[model samples]
Target: MAVASSDGEYEDDPESYHSGDSEEYQMDHRPWLERTAVKRDIQDLYTVKGLYNPSLGLYRYRVVDRLGEGTFSSVYLAYDSLHNLHNNVYWLPEETKSPVGNLCVETGHQVALKKILVTSSPERVENELSILENLRGCRNVSPLVTAFRDDDQVIIVLPFHACDDFRYFYRLMDPPKIRAYMTCLLRALKDIHARGIIHRDVKPANFLFDYESGHGVLVDFGLAERYQSPREATCQHEPATRSHLHGQRCRTDDTLTVEQAVYDARKRSRAGEGKVGFRQEDARPAVKTNRAGTRGFRAPEVLFKCPDQTVAIDVWSAGVILLSILSHKFPVFNSSDDVEALMEIAALFGRNSMQRCAMLHNRTFISNVPTLDEPPESLASLILRLNPHLYTPHQPDPTPEEALEHILAVDCALDLCAKLLHVDSTRRITAAQALRHRFLGNAEDDGPDEQLDPTEGKCGLLHRWVDGQRG
Candidate 1:
């Protein structure tokens, strides 16, 4: 539990801003001269800081401090001053409202006001808002409170989720806690994927988790987009059906399947006809598609420049998070660029598998590293090497049954990890399927009791603030 703050400037005490002696209270019911003075005070605090000008929705929200700043937007912690006056009703466009109306906002509700920068295109801003509206009421997904625009500066209001930093508890989380974390994340992904949405960015930073209460919310849909299949082209090859890229066990004799053998024979025949090399006279254009995602967490297909990327790419990124938890590493793949990222993946899955993966996208992969020629290491071996304490008992003398149970739990987690990290996009586990995985099937029973609503009272915020100090 941690109260959301930026640079220790976010004030959690509502009285500090709403006291009877303060200008805000006097402005509510006072003489014209006094009200004008209060308005000037508000303008000096908000407009002068460049958070929100008086012409925007400044009358409804009072800016406190900045929460975070990203490439496309800056988030500020603010209080909804009009929520109490409106009887806890949330203001939304008529077409955007549900049958029961938008989610209610309490009096003095804390919210994260995300101001989209002018550099972002109008289409991009609209797309992000449209996606958020469609995903309203989805469990574990942050709900949009409201949005306002004034010329180029736009503010999208979202609930301020109080949670601990991932870096503070990633290594400290036990197996059961990890299960709960993945379960919440996958549930959010399942809801969005069912609607054909692809969360291009699915890293830990985008997922806020209150580890003590076992609650989490997926936020920041800026990079999200609907999946659209590309039209079939003559130059594009059909996806490989029996590639070793999925990490399936091979036969002891190293015999190839009939379909693979026939495919290889056809390739050799084409090579004999001098059709393998590049043609100077060819007129075909290069394939290009959206490649918007964070590095290291990107899927192999994304690195391979696959034109028909799908929701499976998000699943791969989730697998990277799982790998980090298992290995006690924040970033399992710390590559600087796409080329280096692909090379890092090759070092784990090996070069032959990488080549077959490239064939899926009608591309070729070449690596000069000698070690990549060998078979890939098993996930269990990698995890054990990184975190041997997972299998070893901490006490001086532990019972046999205790050790066996620990080993079994680790095995279950590794199995799920293997399916998630599968290189073939078609074979990668879906978020829905992952929810049923053995490792996370008992997540509800394993985690802490369900937490109270974060916006109920000052208790939630105070509790989180204490947790933050302790952390």
Candidate 2:
């Protein structure tokens, strides 16, 4: 199984290839194999060779254009022939509380394939596949078409999709298009939550357009996990500033800036900070530590005391995305680490940490939170520190309907973000609650016009691992 060139020329198998050990998480997707077997017949004719890298094994792919880039993956335009790679999709079994989106399935059509770079453990890549496999039927969520050990490189196949990705969409979208896209994306989120999972990574880049031409597709579940269990949240890898930059590592030769630290802290928060869980809830388990997340999107809880929060953290990130699209600017809270992220959040929303507030209330708000990295008074000057231009007051406060619509979206999203990204898991908004928001409700009844078969079984293997406890 090596796919040759566009010339349709078959090439010899590369003699020397690395033997990749099957990851335990990947093994967990074994259940999917059984369930997916029924899908082979329908998808057999859809197979094709993938465009990127060490070709080998039972993999269908195609060569297309480049889609996007990131620290860990390279997405491209390609075709997945077998499995109706572009035309069909599936969701969880009816019994599950979660709602998954339509998987990418093209009947000899183009699709987007994200090739993850091999920088971390092989298991990490496997974990992403395992997660995607479980979420196969999740509408808008990218499906894991197939995973193969391509010599030294590991590859996962997905359907070709449109470029209305949120990150870049802002650069090109019109008002009507943005609204329509947001409506579709939010609907996807609603369906996703119905299945008991939390899309931990909900940013512009991760979210692409839906199959409905300009519509959006909710993607990038690498950081996503089910909220049914306690998760180990941390800030070890997190930087400590509020600038929109990558989090800084302690070992780096370059000095870490305050901005970088904030960015890293926010990311760490997404790594499982601001979380809480019960023993029986075997979905996500817990331990507090450090983790870094995309800047601006890092929630207040995670930034201040990561590895100590839960699903609310994702809400914060979602709000940032919503705001960015509405404002057409990079998210305002972009920070380099946790401390600064928290400071920015506090500045915007008023300094009201559940942990600190508990002291005044003499009752539990957020009983278990990470130690604060800054002082209480830092909140007042938080906005001022970040704002170097002083106050350039707008006399009329521009109210373009499109901008106002975005403002409406952001304000609504912010309330949800604040609730879901709360420091205390007890106070956070659950997935069920989020689905009911006005913004999320924008596209509720309007399912995709395309008739996609619902998913087959429960895609909870990875959810059980990342969101909850392992056996």
Candidate with best lDDT = 1
Best candidate (score: TM-score) = 1
lDDT of 2: 0.47
> Where is model 2 more than 4 Å wrong at Cα?
1-60, 81-108, 165-179, 194-196, 210-214, 226-292, 306-308, 353-425, 439-471
Which pairs of residues have clashing backbones in candidate 1?
none
lDDT of 2 by residue, 1-471 (tens): 243555555555443222232221122333544423322321221232334333434335543334556777766555444534223433222222122233244423455666666575676676667667666555566566666664445556665554643454464554445456655565566565544455666777677664346555677776666443333212223221111011222322222343354445446554777543223656644535434467777654444444433444555566566545444466666677655665555544443453342221122222123433343443223333443222222224645764566546544544554454444434545444555656555445544322212244353522343312342
Cα lDDT for residue 224, candidate 1: 89
Deviation in Å, model 2, residue 343 alpha carbon: 1.3
Which residues of candidate 1, in runs, are more than 4 Å off? 1-45, 48-58, 85-107, 231-285, 392-403, 442-471
